[model samples]
Target: MTTILLLASLATLGYAAWYLILCSVSPWERCRRCHGARSHRTAIGTRRDCPRCDGTGIRVRIGRRLLDYIRTEYRAGSQ
Candidate 1:
């Protein structure tokens, strides 16, 4: 009983840490390949938008959509 509960708590905490490492509520990291330029030079001597960043030069983390939803709900409740 007590032992089981302790194991469960530790498991939960481990899972939470793993989740945080695997995901992020906010992603502000710039695209390394494009260096935030949103465009790069091609082998053909032509410039093209970065495919990895979809020309945005920024990537959204997995949990950002959830954070946006929560923020919207909080704002609605506050108002």
Candidate 2:
């Protein structure tokens, strides 16, 4: 039981560190809805901008958004 718990904790910590690094290095990820295409094809063969990413084909990482929120809150509190 203890061994399993230790392994689980180590894995969690490793993933958190990896995600933190990823957030800092590349804070944007391809949009899931458009698969980075920036536009979607309709049934009539017309293309339209991806609604999810607003045609940018990229979205802010959840971790980055969380970090931004935390920073904002800290700044507000400090001031």
Candidate 3:
């Protein structure tokens, strides 16, 4: 039925939003915890191509944009 389809679509959308939130923690944040361990990869986030590393995944992101996006989602979720 159309009603059932609508509910399923809504559920899928909710799950996608949740997945994005869970993957916003980039590896750069972890480096702050342990000295000389900046090579760690993000456990839940993506590591896209970096010009400096030539896709070797050793480069750092310019800013903490991932954390910013996560904070925005958190605020929306709380409201």
Best by lDDT: 2
lDDT of 1 by residue, 1-79 (tens): 9999999999999997776665563456688889889999999989999999999998765566566688899999999
Report the C-alpha lDDT of model 2 over 1-79, residue by residue, as the tens digit. Answer: 9999999999999999999999989999999999999999988999999999999999999999999999999999998
Candidate 3 local lDDT, residue 2: 100
lDDT (0 to 1) per candidate: 0.82, 0.97, 0.55
Candidate scoring better on TM-score of 1 and 2: 2
Q: For residues 1-79, what per-residue lDDT tens digits would candidate 3 score against the true structure?
A: 9999999999999987665565454534232322233333456774434333444434343344566677899999999
**Stronger candidate by lDDT (1 vs 3):** 1
The model with the greater lDDT, 1 or 2, is 2
* Ranking of all candidate structures by their TM-score, best first: 2, 1, 3
Which rank order by lDDT, best down to worst? 2, 1, 3
Runs off by more than 4 Å, candidate 1:
1-25, 61-79
TM-score of every prediction relative to native = 0.45, 0.91, 0.32
lDDT of 2 at 30: 98
Runs with alpha carbons beyond 4 Å of true place in candidate 3: 26-79
